[model samples]
Target: MADQSSEEAARLHKFVDPVSYLSAFVSNGVRPDGRSCSTARNVTLNIGSISTANGSAMVKLGQTCVLAAVKMELSNPPLECPSRGYLVCNIDQSSSSLSEALSGPPTSEAQSLSQTLQDLLSRFVDCDDLILVESKLCWTVYVDVVCLCNSGNVWDACVLASTVALINTQVPAVNTDVELPLVSISSRRSLKLGTVPLAATFTIFKDKYCLLDPSREEELICDGTVSVIYFEDGGIAQITHAGKPLSSERLISMCKDGQTHTQTLYKLLNTVCT
Candidate 1:
C-alpha cells in the first residue's frame, strides 16, 4: 500500500513539472489560453446576486471567481472625520484553494492581494460623500470579499466585485418620529455616488511582454506585476508596481491602455446593472 502511494506521488510530481515549464515558455510570448498579454479574459458580473446582503455582486474573470457583499449600519462618525462615515474592507481566501501540502491560515500571497484591493478601493471612494449627518450619526459601509475559486488574477476579480457591489448598494435614509426631536431611525435609501473607479493589472514577463489580467500559470513565470486603478475623467487613482522598476514609456502605455479599458468596463457595468 505504501509503495502504491509513493508511485502516485511520483507521478503527480512528474505531471506538474512539464506543465510548469510549458507555462513558462508560453509566458515568453504566447499564452496557453491564446490571449495577448494586453488583453483581458472575458469578464462577467452579476449584481444583487446575494440575497442576504444589502447589496452584492459576483465577478468572474475567466475562471477566477469572487463574491463581494456590502452591508450598511448606522454609527456615530469618528471625531477626526466627523462629517464622513467609515468604510471597512475585509477579504478572505477559502481553504479549498490550497493544496494538501499547504495547510494554514492565509499565506503571504493572500494577505498581499487583500491589501492591494483595500488600497485600490480607498483611492476611488470619496468618503465625505457617505456622510448623512454632521457628527451624530452616519452610515458605516462594510465590504467583504470571499474568494470562491482561484483561477489566478484574484486582484482583478476582487476589484471587479467591489466596484459592482458599491454601485448596487443602497444606504437607507434615517427615519425620525415627529415627537422625538428627530432622534428615531425609520427608513433607508440609496447613497448618491459621483463616479466609479476601475482597476487593471498587467504582468511583465521576460522584460518585454506585458500581459494584462494574467492567469495562474502566467503569473508563475512573470518577472513582476503592475496594477493601475483609474477613475473617470481620465484621472489615476492608484498605481502599484512590484518586483522591478518599469520603464517610463511602458508606464505611459499602460496608463493609456488602462483608460480605454476602464471606460469599457464602466459601460459594461452600467449595462448589466440597469
Candidate 2:
C-alpha cells in the first residue's frame, strides 16, 4: 500500500540519520510531509456513522483516525455531585496498529493517554447539562474512543471525534410526573450542547523544532509532545505535556499556535454539525 510504503520510508529515513531527519525541519522549515512547524493536518469529522450508538463520530486528522461513540444511560447521580451528570471516556487501541510504536497491547502509555484525554475533555464538557431530574436521575454519557489508525496525533483525533459525537447525541426526554416508581420516557429528544471544545497537538523535536500534527514517524523521533484544548469562545481549558520537558517560552508558543488551530477546527466542526 502507498501508506505502508510511506511509513516504511519515513522509518528508514529517520533510522539511517537522526540528525539529518531532524535537521530537515530546521533547514527546510517544513517536515518530510511538507507541513510547516505549526500547521495541523486536514481534519474531517463524520457524524452518525454507527447506527447502533446513540451518537457516534469519526475524525480523520491526516492519517490518524479515531472513532468516538456517545452512549447515554439514565442512572443515579454520584453522592459527591448529585446535581450534575458526567462523561466517562475509555480509549481502546488494538495491538495491530500502523506503526511499531503503537503495535502492542494496552500499555501504560496508552492508559495514561486515555486518562489525560478524559481529564482534558472533562473540563470542556459539562455534565450539568445532562441532568434531567436533578438529584434523583441524571444521564451518564459514556464516551468510547477507538483508534483505527496511528499515523500520529491520536489525542486530537479522539477529542475531535468525542466532541462531534456528543454534539450529535440525542438523549430521550423523561417525564417524572408519572406515579411513584414509574417514569415516562420520550424516545425522540436531543441534548443542547453548551460549549464546543477544540484541540491541537504539538510535538517538540530535539527541543527546537515544534511540529504540529506530527506523523507517527515524527513522534517516534520527537523529544516530547503537548496538547492544548480551547473552548468555542477561544478560551483555553487545559494543557498537557509529556516526554522531554518544555521551557516556559516554548509552552507559550505552543499555546499561541493552538489558538489558530482551535479556530480552524472550530470552523470545521461547526460546518459539519450545521
Best by TM-score: 2
Model 1, 161-196: lDDT tens digits are: 987898788765554333322422245455556567
Per-model TM-score versus the true fold: 0.81, 0.84
Residue 107 of model 1, lDDT score: 73
The collision pairs in model 2 are: 151-216
TM-score of 1: 0.81
Q: Which stretches of candidate 1 lie over 4 Å from their true place?
A: 1-29, 98-106, 176-187
Clashes of 2: 1
Kindly give the stretch of ten consecutive residues in candidate 1 with the minimal lDDT sum: 176-185
Query: Could you report the Cα RMSD, in angstroms, for every candidate shown?
Result: 5.4, 4.0
